[model samples]
Target: MNEFELIQNIFKASVMANTQGRKDILLGIGDDCAQVQVPQGQSLVFSMDTLVEGRHFPFDADPVDIGYRAVATCVSDLAAMGAKPAFFTLGLTIPKSDPQWLAGLAQGMAELAEPIGLTLLGGDTTKGPLTLTLQVHGYVEVRQTPLRSNAKVGDDVYVTGLLGDAAAAVPIVTGEVLVSNERLDYFYDRYWRPTPRLIVGMALKRVVNAMMDISDGLAQDIQHILKASNVGARLEADRVPISAELRQWQPESALSLALTGGDDYELCFTASKEQASEIQLITQTLSLPCTKVGEVASEGFSIEGYDGDISGWQHF
Candidate 1:
């Protein structure tokens, strides 16, 4: 089928199925530009992520997994800023229109978007190498949204959820390593379907001084906050959270992965010392593990005990 037909039969149908109960999206698919009404006393926050085949995912990756993860990883930006997810637009390019693939991709995205209250507003489909660019829109309270540049000296540093699993999964997904079924399942799930920590972000919004999602490795991603906030950090290497599965799989490499591996999607943030008890209470209420890895320093970044490279995922 042609591009327009494919969008109507596959993508538009997916949008209709997933966007139910969303009143914020005033105009959606089939428009030249989608429209939404901004809520009072709130600001619009959006981010775009581009995922290329083979580079971002396995060439043979399932379309559904790709779709789900595309949304998950992109919406993670919103979560970092303590924004509530609202709408997203897709920009899909493929060499050919495969009905089944399109359907799976759409289904995968819809599943993730539904629970998070994200609606499909609009997008473009074109013929080319397989690439998906998703732009997600969220709303945040004006002046209340935490920023990467807001970190202050003496602020406690924290990260939500375990790190390094997604990085470890790369070798397994690419068939470069052999692993047990348990290991395979755990790592695969971590890579393909990471939870976007939206609730945690919202809960910590008022508490955190500076925040950003770990897209690149902590070694690299944390630098952005440090530079932006004009502060430095000294992370305790042992404090970085590693999953039991990863430690069991590769004890020696687990620390490296947790330190320098990418795609964790967990929040790496800083908060004042006074908010420590409240942060603990929030994490307990949410039943999510939030680890205090270090504290913001006056100058210079250092991770004690890890004397290796910190080059995270580089697009170049």
Candidate 2:
């Protein structure tokens, strides 16, 4: 089939199949640029992420998982900003049209979108090496959006849920580790499907001074908060939560992996000492486990067991 016909048959149908409640989408597919309307008194918070085969995921990875991860990662950004997810646009580049692959991908994306009230508005398809990009939009009350720069020196550092499982899962997913079926499934799910802490972020909006989702390890993500807030931190190694699965595998490296390895997608936030009691109450109400791992400081970032040095993921 020709390129245009291929897109019409595969891409166009894929776009139309996922139905979401998006009244403001004035124009969607078949337009040069999709148009959307923003309601008054609400500010838009948008983010985009690109995932390339081999770099972001294994070349042989399931297309469905790839699609789910692409959407989840981008939506996590919205969650960090304490925004209500609205809609999204996708940009897919592939070498050829594959109906089975596209169907699986659409199914995965629909699974995530349906749960979170997100709608797929529009996107473009092109011929290239496999790549997926998602641009997500969300809404926040005017002047009420959280930012990374708002953290204060005396604020307590916190993270939701356990860490390190996703990092530890990598080797197993790539077949570097031979684990039992149960352990294998656990690790694979942790790596492939991350639950973005959207509800927690929304509830903690006014309470959290600064917040971010841990995409590139706790240590590295915290650095972004530190730099933006013009402060340092002292993270306690023992206080950082590590999963039982991760602890069982490499107890010695548990702290290191939790602090340095990536793909946790949990919220790292800061609240004042006075707000600690309230923070506890909120977490309990939401049933989301949160830990006070450290406190923001004046000078530089340091982890308790790391001898006053910070060791985390480095892209370079």
TM, every model: 0.97, 0.94
Residue-level lDDT of model 1, residues 183-247, one tens digit each, is 88889899999999999999999999999999999999999999999999999999999999889
Q: Report RMSD for candidate 1.
A: 1.2
Cα lDDT tens digits, model 2, 146-235, are 799999989999999999888888888777789999999899999999988889899899899999999989988999999999999998
TM-score for candidate 2, residues paired by index: 0.94
Q: Which regions in candidate 2 have their CA more than 4 angstroms from the true location?
A: 1-21, 307-309
Q: Which residues of candidate 1, in runs, are more than 4 Å off?
A: 1-3, 18-21
Report the Cα lDDT for residue 279, model 1: 98
lDDT for every model? 0.90, 0.85
Rate residue 22 of model 2 by lDDT: 63
Residue 240 in candidate 1 has what lDDT? 95
User: Over the full model, what C-alpha lDDT does candidate 2 score relative to the true structure?
Assistant: 0.85
